[model samples]
Target: MPSPFRLRATALTTTALLLSALATGCGDDGGTDEDLTAQKLSWKDCPAPSQAEGGGSAPSPLPDGQRWQCATMKAPLDWNHPKGDTIGIALIRAEASGDPSRRIGSLVFNFGGPGGSGVSTLPAFGTDYDTLRTRYDLVSFDPRGVGRSAGVKCENDQQLDAYFQQDSTPDDAAERTGLLDNTKEFNAACDKNSEKVLPHVRTTDAARDMDLMRQVLGDTKLHYFGISYGTELGGVYAHLFPKNVGRAVFDAVVDPTQTSEQGALGQARGFQLALDNYAEDCTSKIEDCPVGDTPQDVKDRIAKLLKDLDAKPLPGILPRQLTQSAAITGIAQALYSKDFWEFLTEGLEQAYDGDGRILLLLSDSMNGRSENGEYSNIAAAGVAINCSDDKPRYSPGYVEGRLPEFRAASPLFGDFLAWSMVGCTDWAVPGAADHPDVSAPGAPPILVVGNTGDPATPYEGARKMVDALGDGVGVELTYKGQGHGAYGSKDKCVQTAVDGYLLDGKVPASGTICA
Candidate 1:
């Protein structure tokens, strides 16, 4: 829950289980000068989540006997300037429940968001940590410009409140101008407040910090679990430090090979498929469904609601009305997990009754906007990372021309998702090269997991990631499931395969498909 367009688990850090079927053994560390001198982490007793103080998602209570220790690592704000200004990298280590002498080195976890707070998620590892803590220490960190780290602050709670309610889909010239004006204001505020860190929060920068983290933890190589956007970060790390690659898994893959426009268009198609799946399920199961019996009916009803909101916003229980942006955000969030589909049904019911409270709350929850209007910097940092990583694939005129294609991709969500990229046209900084070849040569077998019906990151993206990694470098594990991520779902096959990999460095056979 960060950007309106992206969906991720609220608590689980990028959950990856990899059984490395054919990975080459790890090699010597890429011991550059900086790697040799990386500061050792000084661990201290962990503090309770600061959500009570008005930031971060409130994680579930820690499980019995699970102990958490906190630490800070100092990394160069700019990797290019090794002696330049430093920033604190917040880390949390979940001590292995098994014997210390038998413990493997730390396994670093990243729940994508580019803005997702690893510190916030560390406590909420829930059931998976129970098994993970028996083998290796579970370590997660806030990448620079993320929670606990020096986050990218742009707007206050009030400003973000107004921003989220602004029309996301710009139909005409006036609406487009309003949307662009708000985006410019948002970017300018971020530039003003976070000038020192904004230019350096690229995924590559975080990947560099990961090397330092690996060195500090005294591991010869990095064992990584990265999800969604975290996969992008992990891919960068693998590219930069192939020699240091250990057991790594990238789940719910974001294809590093695709341009930003392709990502958006691809997502539009994925979401439309998910919507169809949801519609089929709802009609068969839920009584009095708001969208009627067929997928076409569902698409029509939702599209009408979005267009109607564009013309006339609906008053919600909160002071802010439910605008098209908020409604779309709410809908996208529910698409992440089937468990939340009932919430979607309830929300649609409320929307039909002219009460926007449920839908508005869903949007806020997805954005990490607190009940009191406080906001996490997830959206701010997410944009920074996204803009810095790659150039936008479409210009304003190009996007306008491609509208028909996007609409074809997703009858309900395509236009809005496609237009979402327009903000990149006025980004504060230039992006890195788009869709560069990323093959971590000399790395162990990297397991890439994909959900067949993933909405945010389509299944094709996962296939693309494997293709980018080349034959034998990356192994593909397919889950015939529905959701943004596959590992945490009820499929015991994935969980068992992951366990096998982490426990014994086993990798599943290539092209292994599990349900």
Candidate 2:
């Protein structure tokens, strides 16, 4: 909930199972230096994910019995001085299953938390890309300041629980002051706890690290798959090293044209659209929707629930009540995927009955909390990177002034998101630009896939990314679907288009539509 603008598509399968138990459940950067790129990685069997990566078991082997391998690649801590101190970039891979002669080099992927741990995420969805692995080593890594890569650390788990529980949408001056104080305290903790890494975790720094990664991996060009925030990193890489890009694909594309404020506003509209779609889908079903009698009814009930919760909180996972902010966060989490819409309906139904378990569980997932109550570094690193990359810092007055416009965009989510713009307030380091520079004139044709109903990075971003990447550089493919990303949605048309391009170098015609 730190930077609501941050996009992530974490697996919710385990989360769904938890909900059935009691109707409630538990749950970077850097650069260069020739010697760094030439360093060898000692691949080993992956250990259980560290607490910072969101604790879980070691990744299981692929369906074909090929084991997943792990390694650490050293990269400069600061891109400005590549030969200075270095940090390890943790990596994971499943080698190609096909003939060595048919191998098309490593296909690197960034699953996009700007903080999501590729070291842990890739295996969770490994089988989804087995087709591509037939001819390429499927690879991913924990970007600097994430997971095992000297991950940025802020408040201790206890501090974070209190931080997140505080009122996020203030109704008066006292509440507003509390919100700003909390934001400042959180930022100060990040600076206090992660001063060494905070200033160096911008997207531009991560892009340079990818170039070094390509060299270390023995690939001539970086064949990449970027989703959500990953798309922004890819675009920056293309702009910085256009000629070195090869067979890249960006799904859930971020708009390179907007400032941090504009991006947040766009998310307001995008999420409202997704919520509308969710309401319509639920009510239009042959079976009666348990949450409401009609589409507007569904939304109306949800709005009233939020209003009621604001005034009087409900019991959530024991010892933690579901506050209004948590409910909104949970709702936003459920809207990320249509697959989770069932869970959303159930969560709403349960919340209405005074059982806040399901909704709070969803909120935990969004905040990177595990069933055992530990949190991943996703929140810390997301705030660090966003604050470092985004130049503008908004005052409480500015947010107050924009409330009307944000509310106009989304009555349910507007206040929550508008207040999130202050996540960077009183930060430790200066930001890099008004927005990322992604104009890559000479980059290869990068396939850009957009989902019509993506809540995080709205569909319009795909076309903007295509145009910004320069004509002929970004090939646009539209998936008339509902999810944060298309390829992962398992739409056959999307899979085929992406596989053809990444596997056989077959770029779909620009503006290709997949319904």
The predictions' CA RMSDs to the true structure, in order, are 6.1, 3.9
Question: Which segments of candidate 2 are over 4 A away from where they belong?
Answer: 24-31
Model 2 alpha-carbon miss at residue 390, Å: 0.2
Worst 10 residues of 1 by lDDT: 16-25
TM-score of 2: 0.97
Model 1 earns a TM-score of 0.92
Deviating ranges (above 4 Å) for candidate 1:
1-4, 11-38, 50-61, 286-291
lDDT of each: 0.77, 0.88
| Candidate 2: 10-residue stretch with minimal lDDT | 22-31
Clashing pairs in 2: 27-371, 113-116
User: Per-residue CA lDDT of candidate 2, range 1-515, in tens?
Assistant: 33564554553654776677756300022235768878998999999989898888999888789999999999889878888899999999999999999999999999887799998888888999999999999999999899899899999998888887789999999999999898888888888888898888988878888889899999988999999999999999998888888899999999998988888889999999999999999999999999999999999999999999989999998899999999998899889889899989988998999989999998888888888889999998888888898999999999999999999999999999999998887998998899888888867899999999999999999999998889789899999999799999999999999999999889899989999
